[model samples]
Target chain A: MTSPAPLVVGFVAATVLALTAACLLGSTPMGVERVLAALIGSGDAGDRLVVWEIRFPRALAAFLAGSALGASGAALQGLLRNPLAEPGVLGVSATASLAATFFLYYGFVSVAAWGLPVAAIAGALAATALIAFAAVHTRSIITLILIGIGIASFAGAAMSLLMNLAPHPYALSDMINWMLGSVANRSLDDIALAAPFLLCGLVVLYGTRRGLAALTLGEEAAAGVGLNLPRQRLATVLGAGLSTGASVALAGAIGFVGIVAPHIVRPLVAHDPARSLVPSALLAGLLLVLADIGVRLIQSEQELRLGVVAALVGAPVFVWIAVRRQAARD
Target chain B: MTELIATGLTLRVGRATLVDGVSFCLRPGELVALLGPNGAGKSSLLRASLGLQKRSGGTATLGGRDSERLNPVTRARLVSYLPQIRSIAWPNVVRDVVALGRFSHGAAIGTLREADRAAVERALDACDLLHLANRRCDTLSGGELARLHCARAFAAEAPLLLADEPVGGLDPFHQFRVMDITRAFVGRGGGALVVLHDVALAARYAHRLLWMKDGRIVAHGTPDQTLTAERLAAIYGVRACVDGLRVALEGAA
Candidate 1:
């Protein structure tokens, strides 16, 4: 069958808004004519810097972060075979938080400029190793989720300790900013930093679509159908972990996109797990872009973290859908 | 010949030995019914025969190759199996679930061949599940879900199929339809070994019966020879009789 109508509409909206958001959220806001002139490369140097050096990066980060989280959620759910499985539940985001905390607060690294995202990625990989180690007993999705929770909690405790013991005001602020998340001061360098990891994560997630489809039959059954269990598990963990790490590194752990986007797109694909990835990615891009736009329109003097805003909107919707689904199961 | 033959096969689960020294030979174009009381090792034997359970002794051979030694993809092409426990919170449509049987043959698993689609369609049609193709399996009745699985098993188009009580949850109509589809498989030169509870169904559909008791084959022959009242009573501790078309049983063990 052809792609669903909503998917088509979603792509259109995402494309339009991506360009518009690119033009708007720069170093400085410009009028429509300057924005167009900037778009066509005929604008003033300041307008060009505002568009290229500042706004474009933030907009790109929003798109990638949302896509990564969405794909991560979908892949984790498929791997764990639980709808409740999110990036945080998989321990990736929590590990990133812990690593970011350590980099910003405790250590004054030589490459301190790149410490936040680097440490976050290291944390993500560590969490992945821990989860992977713990997940080896029996092939229970519940077991994977439980292991994820343990890692996340452990990372959370470590992060708190680091925050309390931070060296100075600059360190404390850095930890808090990394934890809360923001696209506010992102530059082309920040986007470049996150792009490879997020893009690679998306590629890995895309590669596993069919294997994930086989996963719906359960692990051993998927293996019997000629999928190597270890390989699938590795790809799944890496994909989800990279996405979570990238999101935490650039946007600082935007929650709910991972949970919400997959749930929404999976149904339209008729629960075809293979098709869940790309759709989940696009839908997530739409979601974060809209949420970022909402944050702007609210006009708060105090900056709002993307994660808190998502939780505010996502938790209720998630609960309602979950309750409805649980009712259906019964 | 695409026959499934097992010799001196033994399967153990933990400390419990499920099948000990089981031997059977099932030719293509025939259905062999495995009959046993609960926990008498019918499922274990099927699992062993399908290479889902690693045999502790001897070997199960399909198409002249040791079943366990066949490459995974080749083995998948040679045999398909359906376990008793099926669904687990999957919202996949019935048809997509069936198409998964082609995972081995497809290009890296996402693409399905024209032949694969044809097989899936034929399997779905054979199981009379065309109307429910797009319906989510979670919405299906137990019987319908069982049929959906049967359709998948059929879609696999393996020469040898090991099915554990395939018609267990089906209503009589769908039960017969599943049995008919299974029968059609054998008719088309495929071999099927089915574990079944319904004695009459075994008698009506299977060309041979292997009555298992306490993890051993107590009797193996035609239905009329092996399903005698004495053998039935010995295996199941129940009184059983065949009066004309009716095989009556007063269940105990």
Candidate 2:
């Protein structure tokens, strides 16, 4: 019998194909031909505006954000050396969420629209900086996660305080919408705001690809091989946080993409932590795109937020992964 | 021949000094074993040499250069290191893990320079891991995992190889295999500085011995000079007597 590599390759290739298909068909129910016609630039004005102005931009945001989260998750899992670590668990997501929340409550950008997520992205960087301080000093995954949890708790309290003192319905509604997360009615501006930081984060992470591999030999071995631990730690935190922050700002707190992307891509790459970064990014983009599409496919008249669907899929999948891991250990 | 000199090196961790006033030098192609029990400063001293730990006093020089002057990439090109036990967070394949050794030498992550691929292949072939190259590292047995680590370190192509317990948990056959490979590495214009626990293995493989007790070197010389019965009894609190074909360590072995 042949090895399992070919089977995994087939599965990944199929997933990519399906993700592309979903992206094409994702803006449907507005009209299939309208999406097709819009692509060809000959659609009716109403359908054209609907496709171009709304769904297309939102889809791109979800795709890019999910990809960033996926790549970041894989890298953090490798750098921290823990299977359970994610943007959300490590407080990277919470830090970003609080940043977004503050933006919502205080209107940090003082704009009519699109500034909330921008401020939220900045918040992600701030939180990442604090967490990196703890992670970089010593190469302990447990300490980093613990520090992230502390940051998350602190951010959570701050979030509660903001919610309590919200001045009006708009603030409360915006905060609630953000906390729950949605990609609804997002503009190209949202996409533009989050993209550069995510790309930069990706570049930073790519540079550490070798250093991260050296790390697999343990921090000491990594140092023996001439890896700069402080620099690697900085790259991991900032890269992961920037991508995560931008995504969270635009999409609101989408859970499990980080965990799921790396979890899937690692096995696909036969568990090579270094190469796992790129595949994780690809798979995360695909997973989020598919999930976003799933939301539209099951669209209800009452409008089910994408976060609810991700939770429905993401939470149980995460729990199953945990159970399987525990069973394997046993 | 390249020279590694550590003079009056003092490494302190927190409030505790791990290695105090330790001075040693290693020449090219020599197989020197650092002997000490667990919690001794063997690992700490090696780390200080590699700049992984801060030395409280003294300095280390490699090839007549201030060793710390070598940047991360340059340092990696000079000295290859292997730790005792490492945590594997991802399920990276053995081949890829071995290839990671070439990272510092590569132009970028995706582009493996011609020399990088050659080194990776050489490493895999040297460690007899060619068949298992495609296997996931996490799926390998303990002995197999250790062998893969050897391949990774060898792939680094450094002049000096520092290994902390490189074959600690392996079975006898694998231990022999690992030591033989290590010796082979040294024979190929390189030096090996190994930290070993088994006195017999140290006796069998090492060309020189640096016997450490507590935080200081009790003795440093050829095995015949340093592995005296009196010194063994003093450092290990176990008498060593070799009669004809039989060897004893006061039941310590």
Candidate 3:
């Protein structure tokens, strides 16, 4: 019977620990004292440059992106009342990536620095709207997910087309890197660009927490309890779209963090969907920071993609959960 | 005072009219049972009257406000609904499932308030589930799960309760236990509109009976008047012997 207060305290502590480790344990390692000084603007130029300019932004991006994805996943799972539901399951991330790749292929980056994220968000919204429409028409959860998968496949094909027709070798390589997903080399500007959308998405999802909890009883019962189903649906889909879209725009398709984070924290929150959101977000931020740290630590000829590490670690966990769920059903 | 009032309620889904021109008033201190065969619009009428479904034409009011226009919080406070389908998506504890009733009362997100806790405790006690309050809902037996859902509706402590087959799939003892709880709810100055298939139980427990057929209420009165042999044969196509509160179905008409 782990209560929410203690669980939140534990997660916050863990997040702080992970954040500190991420700042201090990079390729050119800095001592704790130097990291602390750099954080407070009292360290020398090179130390500050290493800590503030490089590692800080990347860690912050990972944290923000993970938090957004985790909150979005929790919200989606609650709304759908399906444990397997995640932002990726809804085709949002794929469509956002497709849009970003579209912009990258056409050299839309020259139009404006914010062009890619804006395009990604727009694509995410469009895909979410399509899925929402399909979901409303279909009562079956399986059908809704199948429709989402269809949309994802369509977007995936479009992305492949963009890659095949990439204008130059450099553009192709950049698209490849973006598709692999990384928070490395990201600047504070990238974080700033994605922050507002992420924050807005978090707020939207947070506001729907109560409604999501009600929905666990099913839609009619939720409505009977005075939950506005349409409004809750809009907030959840739009929020997921915005947060996931922004995350994909900033960090490519970082898979499994959204789905994995909530699964880890769900039982700790006593399976209360509304109570699961904040902890899931915090834990997800921690998970992503640690994963990013792992990306740095793994000695390889070429740097491992953060997304690759997440999926490599996460896919097996997902399969294990599915198997366990099947066993339980039996 | 009237807890729920409906007038000329009609529900149509495309070309089908599930509930047509049905009207009823539920008052405090009364437990009304809605009995009908399948496709007789019992569930649809309840859903439409509660504004959970779109009514083609009519008005339903709860606590003197139009149910269609009532805000969610106020509507939740005025009426509690127990749908026929009983499902707990997650393996939430019994207490948490009951606390969902307080969604409109606020504090649905964080820790429960003192009042909310008291209400949940009271509900658990009423349904005789306090001992199993911490048990995971998915692990509960069918009868226990039925009682748990009853407790969820009871937790709302609203003036009116609309339950669709609240005791369906329960054993005999639990069935009577649930009906007794419904009766007790009305005895304590609340109102209830329950849909039941058991004519004998409805006869024994309900204060009145609303017998429906083909999307219309063919009879609305005391148990004696509504469960007549002629009506039983005509509506349900069953030959039945009725003795006081006990009804025995003999054969198909």
Q: Per-residue lDDT of A1-330 in model 3, one digit per residue for the tens?
A: 556677789988988878778889777868999998988899788999898889889988888888888898888889888777776767777888888888878778998978888888888888887877877787777887788789888988888888888878988878776677789898999899888888888899889888989988988888888788888889988898888888888888777787898898888888989989988898888898999999998889989998899889877877787688889989
lDDT of 1 by residue, A1-330 (tens): 524456757775865766576567533557878877776788798887777766666776777788888888888777767787787656678788778677656565556666666677778777876676666665666677778778878877887788788778887777776666667677888888777887888899888888888878776566556566678889988887776787788888676778888888877777766777788888887788777766666766787777778878777766776688679868
Q: lDDT per residue, candidate 2, B1-253, as tens digits?
A: 5678899988887899889898998877989999976777998888887677667888997776767667777778878888776655566677777877775676223346788888988999999999998787778998888888888889988888888898888899989999999999989978999999887888788899899877788799877766766766777777778542234777452
Q: After superposition, how far is residue A57 of candidate 3 from its true place, in Å?
A: 0.9
Q: Assess each prediction's global lDDT (C-alpha) against the native.
A: 0.77, 0.76, 0.86
Alpha-carbon shift of residue B121 in model 2 (angstroms): 2.9
Candidates in descending DockQ order: 3, 2, 1
TM-score for every candidate vs. truth?
0.89, 0.90, 0.96
* Candidate 2 per-residue lDDT over residues A52-148, each given as its tens digit: 7776777777778777888788887778776667787677777688887886676656674556655666777777777667665866666776787
Q: Ten consecutive residues with minimal summed lDDT in candidate 3 chain B? A: B102-111
In model 3 chain A, which range of ten residues has the least summed lDDT? Answer: A82-91
lDDT of each residue in B140-211, candidate 3, tens digit only: 998899889989888888988999999898899989988888888888888999999988898998889999
Runs in model 3 lying further than 4 Å from the true structure: A27-29
